[model samples]
Target: MTDQQSKLLKGKQILVTGGAGFIGSNLCEVLLNQHVKVVCLDNFSTGKRINIEPFLQNQNFKLVEGDIRHLEDCKKACLNIDYVLHEAALGSVPRSINDPITTNDVNVSGFLNMLVAARDAGVKRFVYAASSSTYGDHEALPKVEDTIGKPLSPYAITKYVNELYADIFHTTYNFDTIGLRYFNVFGKRQDPNGAYAAVIPKFVQQFIDHESPIINGDGSYSRDFTYIANVVQMNINALTTENKDALNTVYNVAYGDRTTLLELATLLKTYLSEFDASIKTIEIKHRENRVGDIPHSLASIEKAKRLLDYNPQYNISAGLKEAVVWYWEHLK
Candidate 1:
């Protein structure tokens, strides 16, 4: 944890929705390390209990198994919470393309529920997990937060709606909120066994099994590829920042760098080969880019730096090396 983060969060009570999921669990871990009281709310739809199992024994960590889609559950989770880190939402554009209704219900309606509950509970801050998918069809290279294009996927629409609702909550009800529009986040405890799993974990798992990992396009598509620790830092910064200018606004949470799909695959292969040399021979395949897939995406994190004092510690190479080692030790 950073020095400023420790000063702001220590001994405070926090609610982390989706705390059994990858990003949420990491937030819980860091908050607990700061000696902050943590209440974890998760439905386990996509979240795995194993991700949070280690924290179960910590006295500062409390678990509330509930869905964010339920207003009652949201209210219950927000009780006595000093801050709310809302991360409970259905992810993946492809999954949303298959079932838009469920995605909308959880991402939009559920987000509203948390906002209302937090507002009523008088929570100090509500920091949420937004997405780079909100950039949609905009052909910009490095995405800026204020200039967004029309949403192209159901998932994008839902996430974009979250920003809208958050703004309203601030303007109308004076509820404080911050949205972190994350790029391709990957690291320890991220699920590698789902149909909608992010590329890094999925590819790492495949290479560990000596199977060919498929790229969604000709491998030219690129992403910001943020590390989980950097994301945790952003959430903490958002929750802790006293800058009035940073409140009720969205900032891009990324490494300020981009990596092509081919480059990502090669790096993963090289790192994993350190554990098992056979991984060096694993073939990387290619496929047609899926519908609603952005050809390229990156982020300008200058806003976060200026307002939240956000300093991302890991680039792709440094983060990938750490992630590869964790997967080898835990999954292999």
Candidate 2:
């Protein structure tokens, strides 16, 4: 992490697609802090204005109202950019199951457009948000790259396709790109009001509002819930590595630990109960496990450690504690 921080991106022209989304906004904030001139692009499909509102005053930051699905918009956003941190996409397994065409439009076609634009514009590197769900039905205790199972949902298929396309772009066009397969990432600025909001933010908001936090399938399923900071580190590291072997590769960005949903809810309840113990007694409801859901997922960070020098600072417990406080303070 320090390696990324030590090499400042001062005065570099950077374009962060999906810069208004949860992870995207966080990445933009970090890049701006490093004194980079940032161009942010988002169509607001799932991204929010509030995420980028604070940066409006920064002279070094620019926000473009554009969609990646539109090749012209991507072309315009990529002008004179040193790097592209592509984070825009239609996420959520349930949402993808409900409507796959839209997911394909945004996640697949949109990504292709960005690659072409970046390569054409001579961008230094392209880093994107991949998913742990790419492990799909592998049934492995700790998922490793290059051994993915068949993707079950449209969303997982989209992410897996992203890695494939990225490799093709590298060999075909010789453009530098990296894909970070993020585990469940939660942190500040994560929107909790959306229909497909992530687990941590959604539960935190519900508990704060004195509502019940629901668990699916008896809550035995687990994930390597990662924090936003670790992802930020990976993007920065990938962008700066100046190593040929690091380019055109994908790495799992996670804490390398696992926690079941039951454990997550209990932790949230316990933490929030500190302010008001009433939420602790709230019973959890178990619905039929959602379709396209995996039973368990943990990641092996050996590749990231070797290639990107990635070191995660926040484990799930420490991350959730900090994230819950942010949601309570920010969402309220």
Candidate 3:
């Protein structure tokens, strides 16, 4: 950790919206470790306070209970913030399909409010969480930044809109911004309690608890699952890079590899079930394909490699090992 701390975001004040969710919490910890002063704004919609509890006593860290949908909340959170790592959003495609208005309100309107607040706060940079789902219905093997299909779900539309707005902010208001188009991100702190929980954490918890994990659409679907550490590195690079080409551009933050669902389940069960042999023999129940769900998704990360200087440290197998171990110890 100390060796990696050389690129410490030492003098920066970063405001991480939704800083208590899985990815957000992990990002907060990483920033704090790098000696950054972090202001975490969360309304606890999907984020849990427990995730930020460890950093409460750290002078470099401050927590604000607030909603991004409210302009006042955003204004207050962005006060004196040097950079904004915007991660607040309603994430699940199925959930968005079930309640699109709420997704649009929180993701679209809430995101705009944050952007306005960040602009008003005089922040130097705006780094946001963009999604690979923006490539919805493209039917491509590895998605590139320039090509995207019409959004297949409300969630996808909201994320794509985020990129569009970020671009507008750069050209219209001269707001220097960068976007990291995240693929299937899964690692520690990803909540396994909700109906909309991500597949990796949900599967790990079920395997640990000796419950049969469910596989949707015969488990043939594939994804380019990215680890949180790689994402944190990308964010750090985006925040610091003074390269003229990198600013105001979107880059894919991913492992540049793909894995099928059956392959993923086997890896999770085998890795997690090592703690207890009984979990090794668990069965999987097949379910109907989910609505607004893409069969396969991948990212062409060469742009990030060339511009962001992003070198991902963990591939799918390495990432799963750490994630499984974390869930086994913490979630148990």
- Among the numbered candidates, top lDDT falls to 1
Models ranked on lDDT: 1, 3, 2
For model 1, how does the per-residue alpha-carbon lDDT over 207-231 read when each residue is reduced to its tens digit?
A: 9888999999899999999999999
lDDT of model 3, residue 269: 80
Q: Which candidate tops TM-score?
A: 1
Which has the higher lDDT value, candidate number 2 or candidate number 3? 3
Q: Model 2's lDDT to the true fold?
A: 0.89
Clash counts for the predictions, in order: 0, 0, 0
Error of 2 at 157 (Å): 1.3
Q: After superposition, how far is residue 294 of candidate 2 from its true place, in Å?
A: 0.6
Return the lDDT, model 2, position 256. 97
Candidate 3: which stretches are off by over 4 Å?
1-8
Candidate 3 residue-wise lDDT at 271: 84
Model 1 spans with C-alpha error above 4 angstroms? none
Which residue pairs does candidate 1 place in steric collision? none
* Superposed Cα deviation of residue 204, candidate 1 (Å): 0.5
